[model samples]
Target: MIEVGSLTRRYGTTVAVDGLSFDVRPGTVTGILGTDGSGKSTTTRLILGLDGPDAGHVRINSRPIWRALLAAVRGRGAVRSPLLPPRSQRPTPSGALAAGGGMDPSRVGEVLGTVGIAGVARRRAGAFSLGMAQQLGIAGVLLRDPGVLLLDEPVNGLDPEGVRWISNLMRSPVARAP
Candidate 1:
């Protein structure tokens, strides 16, 4: 569950979000709808603890995400952004291979296949098409098996087929229950 109460954000003289409040309950998909610059992304950022609120508070599963992220950073160092390998290099880390202990390199291949991008799994993500990038992002999110998903324009660059796949995936019982 994610809850936002009287959340507000400002950028200099501009107020991006103004006194917003909402609850994203468990076991359901909640859509945050607004035009561009209407605080949609800002709200998501606040909920994810990527930004501080000038007022009000947000909570995830009854615990504040800001506090949780701070605690996580304190315990494990700040979470570093995942880096995509160079075009000439392998996408999966050598450490991943070491962790698998020389199992067929097909484990990563299988995950890519599951996301419908096995054919281009070896390709650099930097060079992938926008739709492919969206698939990869979805795959990354799926890797965590998160109970709560916060997607900003998730269908923005997807094709009809890809959009359907994502819709179906989000509507799956596990996602709904989570």
Candidate 2:
């Protein structure tokens, strides 16, 4: 579970988040939406412990998140900005998963296949199209078999078929398993 209590953040005179509070239970899909610059990203940052909250707290699974590193480790899955490594440092999807650590080597092919990009599992990520890259990111998330998934603009570059694929995947019983 994710719990946010009276969270607040300010940038100089501007308020990015104000007294935000919510509870996200396990096996559910939650989305934060708003106009541009309406504190959506700021709230996500605060929840992830990427930035400090001025007046509230964030907890995951009943434990307060005290540091950025702990927050990163605690999350089952997340897709933040700049979805992949920079173009210059791109690696094959298999290699990328290897770099993330604690992942089973055999699962690389399995996850790639799950995301419908198995044929390109060995291709350099830098050369993949935007949709393929999004698939790669989703594959990474699925590799963890996470009970929680925080995806921002998950369908940003997908084709119709790809979009449908992801939708079905997210709604699958496996995705909601704890």
Candidate 3:
């Protein structure tokens, strides 16, 4: 369970989020959707505790989002957007995922396999298209298997098959559990 009350954020004169309130109940997938400049990302950041709200409150599963946000959000990239290294870097998806310490090869493999990109585990990320890049980003988040998921435009550039994979995952019991 995630809840927000009067969540508000301002930058100079711009109000990124304003008096927003909502609840994300288990057994369902909620989305913060809007047009450009609608503060969708800002709201997500605030919920994940990556950014502070000027005049509001947030809670997840009956607790404040203080300690569990990292595991919840996975990183800024998952809920904000992906930061892909240049193709010339020739980074493999699996290697790229395992670059940081603590994550083992099997975890990387499981995530890639779930996203249906296991075949490209050894392929250079630089060789991937926009859709594939989106999948990789999704795989990155799925690797954490967080209790709460906060994805942004997760299906933006995916092909039909990829879209189905993500939709299924998001609609699965994991995303809908109480």
Better of 1 and 3 by lDDT: 3
Backbone clashes in model 3: 1
Per-residue lDDT of 94-126 in model 2, one digit per residue for the tens?
A: 888867867777888888888899998788889
Q: Which portions of model 3 miss their true places by more than 4 Å?
A: 66-77, 174-178
RMSD of 2: 2.6
Single out the weakest 10-residue window by summed lDDT for candidate 3: 71-80
* Per-candidate local distance difference test: 0.66, 0.80, 0.77
| Clashing residue pairs found in predicted model 3 | 27-176
Q: Over 4 Å off in model 1, which ranges?
A: 70-114, 122-127
TM-score winner between candidates 1 and 3: 3
Instruction: Quote the positional error of residue 92 for candidate 2 in Å.
Output: 2.0
TM-score, cand. 2: 0.83
The most accurate candidate by TM-score is 2
Query: Which candidate tops lDDT?
Result: 2
- What lDDT does candidate 2 reach at residue 119? 94
Residue range 140-166, candidate 3, lDDT tens digits: 766666556678788777788878887
